[model samples]
Target: MYKFLLFLTASALPGVAAAQSADSDPAEAALAEIVERQDAARQPVELPDGRATQPVTLDAATITVTATGLGTTIQSTGQAVVVIDRKEIEQVQGADITRVLQRTPGLSLSRNGGAGSFTGVNLRGANAEQLLVLVDGVRVADPASPSGGFDFGNLLTGTVGKLDLLRGSNSTIWGSDAIGGVLDIATCGGSGVQGSFEYGARDTRFAQAAGGLETGALALGLTGSWFATDGFSAAANGTEPDGFEQFALGGSVFADVTDQLEVFAHANWSEGTLDIDGFAAPSFTLGDTAETQDTRRLWGDVGFAYYGNDLTLRAAYSMADTERDNFDPAAGSAPTFASDGHSERVQLRGEYRVLGGLSVAFGGEREWTAYSTSFNAREETGISGAYVQLGWVMGRLAAHIGSRIDDHDIFGTKTSFGADVSYGLGSDWRVRASVGEGFKAPTLFQLLSDFGNPRLRPEESTSFDIGIEQGQRGRGTHLALTAFRRDSADLIAFVSCFGATGGLCTDRPFGTYANTASARAQGIEAEAGIAVAEGFRLSAVYSLIDAEDRISGNELARRPRHSATLFADYEAAFGLRLGADLRLVSDSFDNAANSIRLDNYAVFDLRAAMPVSDVFEVFGRVENLFAENYQTAAGYASPGRGAFIGVRAAM
Candidate 1:
């Protein structure tokens, strides 16, 4: 039936020639028909497993909002960007978002243990703290964390419907904490109800429900998910098993008050409880302990938009709150440690087309952040920023230039500039280049905690990239290659005050944060996709990176020099789908000292699905098919081979 569906899809193309025409090549014509349909509908055809048979492409019709703070086609933006839609998310079939993200180029992951553990995603070998994350347009970074970074541990994929990853520095448009890149995530939306449930290895259970309503003047959506697992030991040599549980809920609403005006609001909340292993007494070594960490996060935003013939305006207010608590059975019944953080932001932005091929985009924003720990008093700071961008598009060439200025309550003022150009050689080829500047202010915790440094300077960085692409991804044969480099200075690092009696350590005996480090990262990324046959496809992504510290000349921790992913999928005529993927990583150090090494490893996964009816489908997958034993971090044992089965329903 797969071929019959393809035939029906091809026949629906409005202006395309028939696939079976004697004057046309059947394979080429069929692929062209698929691409046309994808572009016209803005949605790809789904396979039995709810995955798109063909990957989404960055054609003129495909627009990305993350690249320029406004909708822009990838063909017009020089920045490296990747997009994943809901269909692709279901293809991975797991709660862990990292699994689906790993397939993207120039990206890698490091987790402390199994699912729900502290996980970090590194882009182009940049520090995890340098990347900015947004959920439904709300910044969710933890202000109380040492580096003010978002932890991916509790970020499940159940409610996420789309993701846009813009790689490289983009401070001119996004302001601070965008030194590495930006990740924009949108929640599920539509006019129907859908749900899924699965039970897997390690006694794991996962469930999700989402529903939406759409009318001529209004739209509403709500989503909820739950996850629980009896996980394996976090410590490699430990005996006892660790467990984790999480709950999440989100809602959104949009109303058209007039023909040219709209109002919208979004809210999300999540809570997680994770059993963790810590240094045990007596030996003071890494071991299993009766310890657990609880985290709760809440974020929301409300906004309005106005549209005109040649102008658009938007205004928004957003807020985020985070609370964390740690407990140890041996310590006491109450929590042993706790922290709270909060952020509020207000912004106004607008864009206008000055000419048929020229436009101007501008925005201004103000943010206030506060944090408090059990041992410290509440502290707060504020920052305000403004930016402007000029975009020009003439025929096959497109370019953008932008600048920004930010005033920090404690750090004074700073300026950033960026530029990019993209030129299309033909319908099947394109070349692009870009350069950007980035800066990040010190976090509240880094400046006000017991180990804080009141005189710390902001971290700064410069990034550049050049690339060439042939053909669109998942259309016939496609290939892309890119070279990138980034240099960072005044990087924050912890400084030990042991036995010191002078300088900044005169009154401090433990440790303090300071801007005393520099680093450089360079890498090359390559990606290829082939439509090998009518119902089969293959894709691969690879990256070579060299990340080093300028002061110590040592390789940065937990960054592998080489990494690659290979994936293949096939759809049979019997309404059955099969897929497999393999991931490979080279050896890397687990510490800044470069003494401990994590061994090189490879992991494989297999999955299959079949539709039982028009509304329900069954699926299963086996992860770590070979049961490979490896670690992404020292002392942390990764999950072994596991199997899971599930059913999905849609209306």
Candidate 2:
């Protein structure tokens, strides 16, 4: 790895020397090149229903072919879905990954302090561990036991190009812990010179810069962001911690291995510090602060694809070494490491078209993960799985069905399967139905977790969803309403010991991550977007959620009852745009006992943009404009009202 890093550094030396030849690079050569390419490859396909559609929204429903396996799109199927573009992300700069996750429907995000703190999500009301997250299609999740949790804080906002939210049970195509759904973050690819820099504040002080450049077939991109503040008080009132951060850098090389094939090689790396400035214990305040952690990620992926008349053959391998070191409190004290995990995945898949409107995709993959820690524990796990999917469309009826079976070294074998049927109801209406089983394999953190029991089994789930979609195209509207119900067994939960015996158990085995009685989650998702007129758009989403354990009858922790968002944007002549939105969440409970009640809150945001010329545009936004103080995070406080203004210089 060191050698590889050195080679990359050496290769980049020329660009550095060239930039240094100039005075501060004021010409902004990079941004001009990036715009040239983004307009070239991967054209957004027209939405089947003629609404706002892009390659991401339409293709996420199928995992057909890619580095991970077969890549698919949601718009290609009837599954509930949503896709957010890089433009949106860039416009909302300074917002953490968790905040970006919240803007999407059927998903909820919570975080601690600022950067690198414990930022997590309650995806569709499923356990945090039950929701799976992927970066460029490879899983980026906590190796800790199941229910151990994934960190939203680790993702650098600038490195992300787009986010695809495949709503509903996705275990059938994605495998374990996909009990809820998948959040796929595809990094910016096929780069040319592109970069942006800005200074802003929204309850905090911050600065950010990101850019990408390409030479020949190799493209390199990097982004860095920093923030500081005396944060707001907790929900109940206490000094919110001061969180500081530093994360940046990513690069990729794309070369056509042959006229009919190509290969992609990429790497992502970052380092940061998180100071838990808040006090959990007043008496121990002197030594109370949580250690500042140093973090890092090194990953690589390579693949070859052959495009034939009616078939595509693809194969790829991906590997990543992820580490986080916890430095203890006090000056010059050594840190006790929490975990250092490594993962590797290899996949082979082929897609063939048997006839018009009919295609079949099949593939197999193997993944290995190992965890090493200074906490007196370690675990190794492997997953071998194969999947087959068929899609058939004739006239107004389209049908899709898929089945996958994953064999684990432990926990025996598990299978997930689902079928979807959609029929075009005349007069601008279509109806669809789907049913499937999902599962979340216990993570090493859950099974061999430091304080965990080894006898635990994988959690199992089954879900059913039915929906109606209707709308017009281009100048029309798109709408979908879906209702879902899921039943799960061997549900995992923290088994509390209470008082003195409780706090001592830091591992999952001690008082948490136990296989509990069964559980269930039922909910409704409604989404709609329309272009009423040229350059004018309106959109809204609503979700009513109910999540709980059947046996314990305890309301699952951190699950909110209802969440909804409404947004409107208007585009006028002469390159002018304006938008506003409102987000609402119902009251929620924090623990199993339901002793903590968080009041419901609604937030409003406004934005406006105008072109100074064809190549540059000045934009501004006001978040939490009303200054309503609220907490989406548990004990961690949230910032109040804030504002920012900037300019985008595009070619």
- Clashing residue pairs in all predictions, respectively, total 1, 29
Top lDDT prediction, candidate number: 1
Off by over 4 Å in 1: 1-61
Error of 2 at 536 (Å): 2.8
TM-score of each: 0.91, 0.83
Whole-model lDDT per candidate: 0.82, 0.63
TM-score between model 2 and native: 0.83
Cα-lDDT of candidate 2 = 0.63
Query: 544-614, model 2: which lDDT tens digit per residue?
Result: 88898788687777788899888777878876879887888888887777888777888888888776764
Residue 254: error of model 2 in Å?
2.3
